[model samples]
Target: MTRCRLCGSTALESVVDLGATPPCESFLAAERLDAPEPTYPLHLRVCTDCWLAQIPPLITPEETFSEYAYFSSYSSSWVEHARVFVEDAAARLGLGEDSFVVEVASNDGYLLRHVVDRGVRCLGVEPSVNVGAAAREAGVPTLTAFLSPETGAAVRAEHGPADLVVANNVYAHIPDVIGFTQGLRALVADDGWVSVEVQHLLTLIEENQYDTIYHEHFQYYTVASAIRALASGGLTLVDVELLPTHGGSLRLWARPEEAAGEPSGRVADVLAREKAAGLQELSGYTEFSARVAKVRRDLLRFLVEAAEEGKTVVGYGAPGKGNTLLNHCGIRPDLLPYTVDRNPYKHGRYTPGTRIPILPPDRIAADRPDYVLVLPWNLRAELVEQLSYVHEWGGRLVFPIPELSIVEVER
Candidate 1:
């Protein structure tokens, strides 16, 4: 039996099983398509002790992140979101030219670029070489290394303790939650703040966002569970904000337990919400498997009906979440045929497991398929706006999660 990573408890209850799937971001080159692709069981379990939803670490971080394929700059909306966050955080934290900022898992320096624009001293620590190089090219000093207690000490020695440590969308990717949080504590100055963003487990279960369950994300957190995790690393929650990113996420601000800061009312408000939602009990997670199974059935039914009607369907984004959805539903190129992505790195590659060929966005306009499946459904509005011209060809957009539905695009 796999023990829970957070509390080291053996009493882990099954939440949802996605069966075996390749690393979601493992886009394959044409030359490598003939080679065998490795897959691991993608099962999620909730810790009865800590109430943390997590998956077993089937793959190492090096294998999943090194030379990574996902780049943040490709999504204009995401970049703009980062820009807004930097602007707000800098002002709220009273950051100045002398204040040092550090971002962990800073993909393509998307957020830190805004920090630099304000003349603040900032650094990005990205494990992915491809994206780290991009960050460096964009004039953001980046360190290509994973954040751990040891690495954190090394970073603090090289560059003085940071005044603001930002870790957005990285809390879930970390398997060693305790160690990573400790590292955050080590890198931040005594008075500095550590900000973390994680997709709320309540949203995942409520919205049926099973697609977000993949190898890359090891653990999901609720406000209560996140506080427990941070406390284990000698940090105390000072504030919490509910963000709309990643469907629904929690942006938590913390500081060393010794630091002087009162808990914000938002913290109590979110904790009460989680309590009412039953996130504190294992019973809350029991029905998740059934919901995920229903999503699979619904998605498969839609694809089969579309195929029977001779409807040509393609995908919009090659995001990791989309891969989980595809692999979990057992979708192949026969159903999806091909998908398009804005990232040139994925253009000529094939999606892992499904082996669906990925093409450029221009292919969509050239072929003008009858239906387009917006894979990253969280960005549906942005994608709809970008592909509004699809209405010119009488094409409709489809969303598979939270139930499969077809949407008519307005001209």
Candidate 2:
């Protein structure tokens, strides 16, 4: 019995298997084109007792997020999402003079700006040195260190207990799941609340979002698993809400165990729905390997067929998720030719493993591809709308996961 890493639960059921692939951030060095790479099996498992979704240990966060290449500000959608989170949190916390909010992994101070705008004092705990520097430059007070029991105590000493602690889509990225939760307990005020947002594991499996199978995300989550994990650190979940951001995600509101109120109907409803949908049951997750393998096969088939028909095939978005899908599908420069990105840091680089060149998005119109693969399938709408001129040349767009389909939208 492979026990759950956080809760030590022996009853784990396989949710889905994504086979072996390089880490999402394993972008190759320019000189190591032929260097051998190690790819780990990307598998999802659900803890029966705690109802937490996770993968067997395969990689470490130090191997995934340290020396990171991704920046949250690179995406327009995420930036807007941060702005909204800050606004709502400030109002909900009744934050203003004499109130303070703190964010863990506050990349580029993207979300904290909203709290700052409300005059609610704010601070950021960022581990990535480069990204943390960027946040500091933007005038967000950022502590460039990992959030841990020791650091949490030290921060509490300096800032006192935080009235609100926000962690957006970072729970799954943490390597020490229990340690991370414990830190939250130590840092949050006695009467204050903590909100954590994570990609919904059930949605990821149901929608076949294999692109999110990066090493950085060690655990996928459902309400049952999350509540149980936090409880170990003397915290209790009070409410839960499903959000549409990041394909799909869960926003959890929690407080100290003693201060927690009766669990809301909102929490019970989602748990019941997830259980009915077989989120924690073994049989429900057993059929996953076949579904994801089909996606890999179907994508290669579509791109290869398009190539045979003399249609120029290119790619959109240089996101880490895109890297996972493309590399796992065994895409090479010959098949994809080149992809384009809006982020300047990625534009002139090549994707890891696949070695496909990445250029600026403008190059897409210049090349005028007959079919452009939308790598960030989550942003299909915006990409299609922005790149609608592809239709001027009778070009089509492709969305690979969930199913391989092409769309022709009018400008």
Candidate 3:
């Protein structure tokens, strides 16, 4: 962290230091609870030169994603989102039966299944052995490997150049930003489109979504910074869209420099919006730490008051972002008790650092907890509908980020 990862500059400013926490997704088995758990510093810094916000690469991607706890198909909304993206991308790019598609970090074939149904050949380059196996089981041709320059080149040589290279929600996961971007360049055709979706720094600051800051997410991007990162790999930004996923994200359409002419006006419009938000300069980040602190205080106060009043508060999802929020706020089982997730892999495991138990989603209705604190608030709409049954027991849902609010759902 002494120098910026993107620009190699010594001038890096602190956006927020969330103290230290374990790798967010490192859930513990009941047997390992007696063993020591390791933690690392989760500090975010912004480069004044490049305007790319990043954290120290304390843990490698292999350590976090090898076996992998997150499966994208578990979220129904995300699956539908991926489905729509596939159909739209195919139509937009004029893809057909002869077209080929490659998705980097494609988890569990949640997206490429759509490509297969469309009679297009597709390949998923996913690192995690287990999830990649799951993808292959679902009939999506997947290569079990990380998306490095070599891997990308090999895939290109074997399958031929992709007509469309899709990287969704993974651009910030790699520490080696330039190399990863180069891999994207290597996998795509000279004239093919590359679509990358990552969390936008503008929405992160404006909405106080500090919980998304974690070790796995090494870099945060504004369109201005993203353009620089893409250029380092011979890719050029062509279009941009502001998405509501992950609280707020940017879907960047890019291509090799030869084919990437003038970028869309939307890219400039978004960059102007980010500049207006003061992200290009240091002023945008000064008050962020304070806002983050306020979020911590408000959530803790609510949890503590609920505990004191004998009102039970359990967590809704044991997502990686939730671990950051829980560890940062110093919440233990006394405040949260246990959280439930639909993902069966997390069942009977414990959240890293906090050591709160993870249970099945049915446990919530069984226990009738007074309040369910949602960790994955990005899926608020979907979760609200799913958890509406809690209203039968007079239970409410709590969201921690962008200011704390409790919602009452109608059955």
As for candidate 2, its clashing pairs are none
User: Where does model 2 exceed 4 Å of error?
Assistant: none
Write candidate 3's Cα lDDT for 146-201 as tens digits.
99899899999999999999999999999999999999999999999999999998
Across 134-157, the per-residue lDDT of candidate 1 in tens digits comes to 999999999999999998999999
Lowest-sum lDDT 10-residue window in model 1:
1-10
Task: State the displacement of the C-alpha of residue 6, model 2, in Å, after optimal TM-score superposition.
Answer: 1.9
Give the C-alpha miss distance for residue 349 in model 1, angstroms: 0.7
Model 2 worst lDDT window (10 residues): 59-68
Instruction: Please list the residue runs of candidate 3 whose C-alpha ends up more than 4 Å from where it truly belongs after superposition.
Output: none
Top TM-score hit: 3
What local distance difference test score does each model get?
A: 0.92, 0.83, 0.95
Per-prediction TM-score, please? 0.98, 0.95, 0.99
Q: lDDT winner between 1 and 3, please give it.
A: 3
Error of 1 at 237 (Å): 0.7
**2 or 3, greater by TM-score:** 3
Superior candidate under TM-score, 1 versus 3 = 3
